[model samples]
Target: MDKPKVAADSPAQVELEEGKKYAYCTCGLSETQPFCDGKHMSTDFRPHVFTAEKTETCYFCRCKQTGDAPRCDGSHKKLQEPERKG
Candidate 1:
């Protein structure tokens, strides 16, 4: 499988509406951050479809490494830490 581009090192804060469906950019090639802009059509990646159960502010992952789709799971923090030098 091809690796996705890194959209951001952190999450994107977005306001979601209840009962609305959103397509998350798994390819990270979208001009729209954290959202699919149909840029993954040529790639092996597919957008993650999610429906909001309630209207609220949510954090979407831009790192493309989260086990949880579309949402931030603090996985980006692992990349933020400085590596220990031997």
Candidate 2:
């Protein structure tokens, strides 16, 4: 499949409930930003299905480039850095 679209150049802080299932957007095409909204249906990508371990605010990756699936690893920070001159 092709590379995912960049939903945003930052993480989405969302409140997750313990024991609740969440479908995080992997394709970066969801209108829901960090959550899945069935936009991946046209692509090979599927939502990252996971259950919240605890009730708390969590940072979810919106750039779709995090090494840690469905979570932010500060990858978005690097993505927005100004390009170096040659």
* Candidate 2: Cα lDDT at 11: 86
- Structural similarity to truth (TM-score) of each candidate: 0.87, 0.88
Using lDDT as the measure, the top candidate is 2
Clashes of each: 0, 0
What TM-score, to 2 decimals, does candidate 2 have? 0.88
**CA lDDT of 84 in candidate 1?**
15
Show where candidate 2 strays beyond 4 Å: 80-86
* Model 2 residue 39 distance off true place after TM-score fit, in angstroms: 0.8
Please identify model 1 stretches exceeding 4 Å from their true place.
80-86
* Model 1 weakest lDDT span, ten residues long: 77-86
lDDT of 1 at 47: 96
Highest TM-score model number: 2
Residue 34 in model 1: lDDT: 88
lDDT of 2 by residue, 10-77 (tens): 78899999999999999988989899999899999999999999999989988888999888998776
